[model samples]
Target: MKFGPIPTLQAKGSILAHSIVCSGRRLRKGVMLEDAHIEQLSASGITEVTVAQLQENDVHEDQAAAELAKALVPDVRAAGLECTAAFTGRVNLVATGPGIVDLQADRLIALNSIDPMISFATVPNYQQMRKGGLVGTVKIISYAVDAEKLRSACALGSAAIKILPPQLKTASLVVSQNANRNDEKGISAIKTRLDALGITLEKVIATEHEIDPMAKALSSLKSELLLILTSSATSDSNDTAPAAVRAAGGQVERFGIPVDPGNLLFLGRIQSRPVIGFPGCVRSPALNGADWVLSQIACGVSLNENSFAQMAIGGLLKEIPTRPQPRRPKK
Candidate 1:
């Protein structure tokens, strides 16, 4: 595409490169200059105007943006995504329901590298999403880009993005509480998190913070998911929560994650149902590693050993006011 200043008489039929006011008329940028516009500019003594002339092989910005968006999410419904109409060379992808972002990093990276004018960005992989949340956006930076470049970007990815919706719908929380600590606050917080992922809290079982009592509670659960929140932090795999999961005919899969606030979290399974041992930080309604694990599991997203190991990066969350023991300790 050609972009530069030209005589007002020669600007007709070209896209206006900049906004201008002449003869009491506001001609916005990207507007196609017509005979009337040129006549007004001429009458206002504006001899020169900037414009963009498209070549036959160039794709308009709006068309390119929409096409790229379609390639990224061919079936919006199936992909759990919805797209806005392309406007001003931009198209936004939104989540159709509560879920987590699923994307092909390599494909998107290659798509972005195709040309500076073509851009695609989205939330991090496995990031939690809400209904109607903005997932990503496609943008064409110039008035038009070469068709070849746009085609390359479109070819790099097809249906490569989606929202992973929840598969687990019911959960039971078994909390171990002491007389000095109130369980109400933790129960409320856990309920809110589960509700967001479409999981119903079937019941809250109050039990002693002991292996035998917690184990009894765990074995009686019938929900698809089980959660344990203890008033005291579980310090080892043989601690109350992990041992109880084992005592209930379950196997503890992982005991520690690299995430700071959620390092004490653990995962186990009884029969076919998944069980999670919550860290104390989960009692507060804040972003934590447990939220990530819960959301992923609820959405049916598999987590390998590497997934827990990788949580170290970007897991240094800000310390909340309610933290019993701060990392640095008081000077």
Candidate 2:
């Protein structure tokens, strides 16, 4: 019966009444019509309804009280309330307090809904309201995940289910083609040497191929870490180690290391997952990049570029030989 920005305050020959909900589509100055009134309008063949929450000071009823009141409705209101009307232009009301109240109309409308509300309307699907959904991947430089450490981080995310995507699997080896002829051993030799060190095939399985399926498997299984065993090639030689992983048709680069015995070792990722390659020295029980990488894994760190760069300091410490010389008996 009425149509305008200010809403027709006075209607003619109509049992129902109406008021302004907001000022020209802005979410200010609205009415708090009762749900019963909305239902009345619905039954009267009025299908559309829009709701808004107005500030208490909006009403000029008591000019003196407007200063102290944050919002204005004919009456004082609280937060978390909604004012409704059968139409859009005019609104007046202030519904407040907790608990969700039913709001119905002819067609479903998106008045003030946030993100997840209209996903189908956008090109890129909207992010889920819940955490962990569509979260970007994190790369770890370490070779394996420490279950205890990973479990702790999972708890913080409050994720009932954690998933490690398949992009994280990597290869492990005791020797590298990156090293000199004397130092470089094939994958078989590295495995054999590790076998001699009391490390069993079951403890760290070997793959005929360069990379292992376990990395992919663990990631798909939401695994938090991947452990890779590798041998160092040479120290300070400017040589690099082989790629930790390569897609079925991916590229491989750098084969030797520039460090000491730890030089031949390498650490890299397959699918953006963390990877740690142990040098031959890991077999010696001496401190090395492998140890530091393992510690980081145990701490559940993602081998992101920044985290990888931070390992330089620890790697330098590994190069130190603090072997204590036997002290002669004091006179």
TM-score of each: 0.97, 0.27
lDDT of 1 by residue, 62-172 (tens): 999999999989999899999899998999999999999989999999899988989998988989999989999999999999999998899997888999999999999
All candidates' lDDT scores?
0.91, 0.32
Candidate 1 has which clashing residue pairs, if any? none
Of candidate 2, the 10-residue stretch with the lowest lDDT total is: 118-127
> What's the true lDDT of residue 126 in model 2?
12
The numbered model that scores best in lDDT is 1
For the record, the alpha-carbon RMSD of candidate 1 to the native fold, in angstroms, is 1.1
lDDT, candidate 1, equals 0.91
How much is the lDDT of residue 47 in candidate 2?
53
Q: Estimate the lDDT of model 2.
A: 0.32
Best by TM-score: 1
